[model samples]
Target: MTTDASQSQAHTSAKHLYQRHQSVLPDWLAVYYADPIELTHGEGRHVWDAEGNKYLDFFGGILTTMTAHALPEVTKAVSEQAGRIIHSSTLYLNRPMVDLAERIAKLSGIPDARVFFTTSGTEANDTALLLATAYRRSNQILAMRNSYHGRSFSAVGITGNKGWSPTSLSPLQTLYVHGGVRTRGPYAELDDTAFIAACVADLEDLLGHVRSPAALIAEPIQGVGGFTAPPDGLYAAFREVLQERGILWIADEVQTGWGRTGDNFWGWQAHGQNGPPDILTFAKGIGNGMSIGGVVARAEIMNCLDSNSISTFGGTQITMAAGLANLTYLLEHDLQGNARRVGGLLIERLRAIAAQLPGVREVRGRGLMIGIELVKPGTDEADPDGAAAVLEAAREEGLLIGKGGGHNTSVLRLAPPLSLTVAEAEEGAAILERALRSTQF
Candidate 1:
């Protein structure tokens, strides 16, 4: 559909450059082979390749840059803060750390939720596990099925995916609840609020059998698990159960937090206005692509930590400054509302297309987070070969897309930043359609 001569030249040049000069990509990154079009810089929702060709980026660096790319305010804050203080030991107090803590606490309804900063989401989840184990003195962790916490041992132990890596297997400390409480032919919806109530009921039954549980970990939307938004009343149900059992409610908002899902700063708000988690961990989007993570835990748990304990370099001045600036723009510009409006429009458009297209199965998620399931000519689950072809074709067409289903079952996930436009959404979907149509599947 791109008829402009300059655009064609740019894409062709990049392709040739990759073919002629670029080294073979590393094996670790081989799991997700990026498009041959290597990027150089970006502005707003669009990114440019080495050849100066622009692509509307719907992926948003895996939903890390929530406000947009090259944000003037955020960049200025980072520059100013870095010039002043790059890194400092945790032995002293920092201004940005204190302010970010206050901001996070005010947004999270928990009155005394204490913040602990880390360098990654994995670390936050890992620390949350350690805290839970210590608090309850229990070994068992109750993780929802299809949940993705992190790659750490404790997190990988709880993750439902078995073959994530060869060494991913661990002593089974996790349990998988059926994706949705209701059973449909192939896929289904979570029947209103009943799904959460059912999940709670199931948990109660399981707890009656188990000796004890330390923590229950889950995401607001199972990001890697087809972006399935947890059912309504789900958080409150989990909260009540954990409160009664004196267990930890750990909400892994690494992917769903920071207003990606709209109407709130965190995904727990998806359930209700002020629903708060006992221990909430955030990483992605906190530093706008910088590797910074932290947890906002209830004071009940924080109080358990000794005064001298829980000190780390996770909340340095530079990272906190970037995070604060990123969040300020998101809040002040009302980007969360943009995510809701644009994402809703995208859902409607894609759903309309799916109504007529072969292999089109489901459209689900919130904000700019989306998952479009691709099946075979007639199949209940995924057709892996077909899915692979779709991805391959999209890559060849100069667009970048990611597949996010835990079991190698296929789904093309769209988690663009909050600033994606209706035109870009349509173009992306059209490219997907063209790929599917061209492939052998």
Candidate 2:
């Protein structure tokens, strides 16, 4: 068939598929772009659309594709595990599960850490909530403003992002706290030291008013809230306050774990004056897209539950195998170091490009997890339309990026695979530069 004819056929097929998807899928399910491309497959840091158009995938399937797409180590482990057995209930001893849990516990930094696997970050966080509430004997919880934990009932209850949380009614009593987003909010004007102090004071006041709260849950870097983060030591300061009250500190490392931030293995370490959080929940990139989630906590808190509990699909042999392989590859290759070097170069390049663009508001974040917030030219107002235009334009330029933010979703989120190379970084930055240029009004 002629190229034109083939293009027409591809468009028709995509349209038909989209219509079918809309007919069946929930209306609230958000898809990227005006014309969403169906990704057929991916390798390394790139993916191809159904129409055979290839793009550098910067979002990495929302950062779930950690080390790389179709990583050979992970794929081989998954295949090998499937050959033996895909799953065995928690009723039986699972070697892979035990192995992964051992590694995570030592790495967790929590005293006498114990790990419990779950199927998704939402489930992992839900489990953390259960543990904290049961241990503390209170349903009142503290969360950061503009934070997003997950979509489940318990997770959403603690989520402070209005854009993602659908309902106000929740099983847990959640109090939204300050210091999540550093660029905006009442504390934004303060210096880092003052900001930390202000947030700590807010927590202290909130704690005094409320009955014994279960725990304080926070994302080291607010992922869905546009890669925003508080001052480095904010959490450590809060840890001091919470320790006094005996409230647990839960680090939601769903997006910030596995050395993505470069300087720290865990995001909480950026604020590491305090020992470690009482609990830590992680998912997205652990299995490198193989579906693994978990929470790590001190044995005392984790063992608080009286009833027997098991996530039917959590810690299945196949997923555990994948996690083991993925973690090994990441460590062996020192992909965290790569993320540091390449991501630093990429962020500097983006900042230089942003300096020349009037609509570019700010360039922020550490390592591979970066956010470029766009705004109205010569003003502080967020420009969500400009962000949308840039996302669409980036796709046209054969570069796939992501959009997010608490303020109207105007921040361009970039989290490529940890294994992204220097050449890929330059290429993706050039494409992004052109995309940002296209958004200039």
Candidate 3:
């Protein structure tokens, strides 16, 4: 019997029955579900929903599609890897796992890097957290306030948003440091030295009296918090502080890693002055749509955790193959160059849009990772309604966007596939421009 119903009443009944499957879902799982045009498939810089609605994908699944969607290279690699061998236990020591691990470590410029793979960014971040705590044997972790590490219990406890309010998530022993204004920083036009000094001061104050901590975890660029990238020396200064305190610095590159930023192979590379992070975590683009993420820790850190370490399915052959293919695609295509070139175009266009849109306050972010903060006239630049309206309208206009930030729906994030071209960038911008131009108050 056909499930498709012809009459409206029949259609309603069918839909209700389909939705009934969701009735059994846990409330916690449902909490994170934001309904949208159900995406059916994607190719290049676009996707179509089940309803046959086509969309220009500007934000690459929140910067995860570093190579864009359905690229021949990534697809071919994954396909071949799948054919060769899929899921062998990590204990078996597959070629894919070993190869990808070696590649990422070399690219990371970290010495003697070892890998602990996970299935999602959150899991990788959790591994980073656990490794940090074990390595230092200290309970406390210092992450920036308004910084999003991940969503699991351990990562969420340190997340500073849900954790800071109402009650204390004390068992985690996570500490927070304020990064900056979180939205608008008047420090914009200030000299780099001045900004670095201010950031250093803020960190110092936050770090005061905390005897010692395991790690200082941070997104080199605050992706969820509006792609906030500090001055040149900020990371360097922060690292100096952490090192002086004997605290490991974990770079949560889940958003900014893997050439998502124009200038570097990893977001951490952009802060070359700062040097390498002791621990690095990655996910999102590694397998394209396939789930894979991992942690890269220095030898010392990995060694510290080895005694008590255990996780099943941490780095299976299937994910390793997918990750290897993803890495191969990046290295071969010079995708980082595309990110730098097209990202500059996209950012410039967003800035241009900001110039025209009364509600747009600032257009900022690194590489393909871009954000537009919406503020109406006479309101604080931190105002957010305009951003929300833009996202909703953009979706209606067949363009996908992501919204995030600490307190307001002010930030419109664009982490489009690294595969986006200059022309595609312009087209996506046109859609956004139309969305902004047509949005109601």
Score candidate 2 by lDDT.
0.92
Off by over 4 Å in 3: 1-18, 26-35, 163-167, 180-191, 306-308, 381-384
**For candidate 2, lDDT tens digit of each residue in 291-366?**
8899999999999999988778999999999999999999999998998999999999999998899898889999
Per-residue lDDT value at 293 in model 1: 91
- The C-alpha TM-scores of every prediction are 0.88, 0.98, 0.90
State which candidate has the highest TM-score: 2
lDDT of each: 0.75, 0.92, 0.75
What total of clashing residue pairs does each candidate reach?
A: 1, 0, 3
lDDT of 3 by residue, 137-157 (tens): 887988777777777778777
Which RMSD values do the candidates have, in order?
3.8, 1.2, 3.4
Model 2 poorest 10 in a row by lDDT = 1-10
Q: Who wins the lDDT comparison? A: 2
Show the lowest summed lDDT stretch of 10 residues, model 3. Answer: 28-37
- Candidate 2 vs 3: which has more TM-score: 2
